[model samples]
Target: MKRKIGWVLAAALLVLLAAGGCAPKTPTAKKKPTPVKTEQKAETVPTYRVVADNNLDKFKQTHGQYRTINYDPQDDLVSLLPESLAKLKKYPQTTTVRAYVTDWQQASVQMGSKPMTVLTVQVQKVLTGKKQLAKQEIRLILPGGFQPYGQYDKGSIYHDNTIPDDEPVLTQNNQIPIPTIGSTIVLPMRKAAQYPAKEYLAWLKAAKLTTAYVPADAHSMIWRCNPQTKKLTTNNPLREKELTKWAGQGNQTWATQYKRLTAELEKQL
Candidate 1:
């Protein structure tokens, strides 16, 4: 009877051991950690506090687009002259128009309830294929009025909102007819205004800006001047330097011519 009891106890012990072995495992230690995202933060966007370009942001644009919705378009003299001067050879009076960026024209260029820069623009020529653009180009378009006798003296751009009081001025545009009415005037001067109208047109045609590669790189910069349309588009270091030097020289020349025209126009007025 003692031996039989011992055998039964051994069998029970074996069954208990088997059940314990079949139990689920307590998980092994893991070293893989969850990654923390850093790139999705808000500070990555590009923004430049370019208020220092000429301290242009000093004033406020009171007559906003929404606020002045009821105002007559005729009330603006500066905006009126460019179109009006289409048929006329000279300005009715000795007028000056200042240039500014398109967006901040009212607030930044405005003077104590007045505008500091009354600018103008005209499309000389538009070229549509690929053209090269230099590092420094004049981006601002002025509607100051362009005449055979007029010029934009970039060298004499003295004050914060001042254009060289005299220069061969032209507006910037990429479309329209060749040698469009007021563009190539009979100045009897070799140094006349020119815009890459054909190149600009080509750019418009192919949906390109200056070249076949696209103007993606230069899209953000201020256009120092429209591309010279005559050349086959290619990046040229000399071209860049020449553009800057030529602009200075051209502006100086225009200053001399401006003095002459201002006097001539003043006498006529």
Candidate 2:
């Protein structure tokens, strides 16, 4: 009976091993690695030009280190339009011309707290004022061009009382771009003394300029003419309003003058 029981147990074990061999195997799952996170930095864009003494030195040797100035002028439409009209009346020599900015020189004289940037423009046509200035090059000393910056002391006449806190404190104040070389512009100007006669003459001799002029009214009087459309425009918003106001006034003389000037500007190259 013990031999028969052992044989039956062995046969049962063999049958169980056969069943295990015929069955399919289970697949094991692999553990995936956690993904890594990366951080990206943002790029910065420059809104305005930051000029320094080194930049002015490229044109001429500068004497002092560049200093930040409160250079924002009271250039609102209300202030500018009346002031401009007064200047136009005072200086009847104010002429409108289409010109090309050939080159520029940094003058020694200071406009408030900065050295003036003088532009040498070749007159292509005279829209108003002297007709003889056509085909001649002239110099214009404007207030707000690229220049080494400085500030007046408190209570000083030149001190800018209303400079905003958000305004950039830089070595130069170029509210609008200095007219680039080879770009065409339509400008209204008048003969003016940037400095005393002796000083002005010395600068003119040194810079090789015969005479220097100034904008008739304000920066808004300077216009960049579209080459294709021949439409005149200004980058200075306050001056643009001043121009528009001056054009829209009830005075027929100014309206007539503005019309003639625009017509002449359209005819130029």
Candidate 3:
């Protein structure tokens, strides 16, 4: 009975082992790794534009006063008043003027406690306030701390001051030079009605006008005269040719009459 019981127990154990071996095995699935996320930097764009009419009032307010040099044939440096200028209703008290930059001086101004740059330009032109200027040179003051954008020589032409939309604006470096030099710029000028003429003269004298210096080859549209009207006009083709020739030959007398007018104005200034 013991032997039979042992055989039955062994048979039962074998049966259990067979059943365990025949059972289906389950497979485990592999997990995928999460991808890393990355961030990108944003690009910077310039928004500043050259000062224009839209902001001119604001600029004047912040800058203190808006002043411009008047091109007068009588008191300023001018030899012969252009017919166009002479014919204008406001000839001597013009709102606009063209000039040639003969020299530049950087000055320091004490505004409150901060020292700032005041650009003084020695210009030669034919018009002023009193009489025709004869080869005269005078110092004109730009009140703000104006710095030029590019290099300029003695003979650079300053057309008029007008900031166009296409004009380049200040960069991140804040190194933009004045656009009036080296080109014909149409700058809008404002009369200082509140300031007396004597006061204006005093301010100019304080600028310490540089020594008289004129380039032999310097020629500007200020000397051109319209043949048809026989008046001072910038549109004279013949005058342009003559100016070009004089400039090529380094002739300082090409605008002799006009330059002489400038001399008288210099004395008055």
Best by TM-score: 2
Residue 142 CA displacement from its true place in model 2, Å: 1.1
- Least accurate stretch of 10 residues (summed lDDT) in model 1? 183-192
Instruction: Please give, for residues 28-130, the per-residue lDDT of candidate 3 as tens digits.
Output: 8888888888768676421211222324445445544333222211222232343332333254344233343333333443322212232222222334342
Expressed as tens digits, the lDDT of each residue in 84-169 for candidate 2 is 33344344657778887766666665544555667777787887678899988788775433332223334557645466433433
Per-residue lDDT of model 1, residues 1-269, tens digit only: 99999999999999999999998999999988889877766665212123322233332333212111011123322211122222223433221211122222311322122221221122232221111221111222211223211222233333223333333233221111012111111110000123345643442334212211111111111122212331121122333454457567775452343234333322321
Badly placed stretches (over 4 Å) of model 3 are 1-97, 111-131, 146-194, 197-269
Off by over 4 Å in 2: 1-71, 75-91, 145-177, 194-210, 240-269
lDDT of model 1, residue 140: 28
TM-score of each: 0.23, 0.48, 0.25
Give candidate 3's whole-model lDDT: 0.35
Winner by lDDT: 2
Comparison by lDDT, 1 against 3, better one: 3
Ranking of all candidate structures by their TM-score, best first: 2, 3, 1
Candidate 3 has what TM-score?
Answer: 0.25
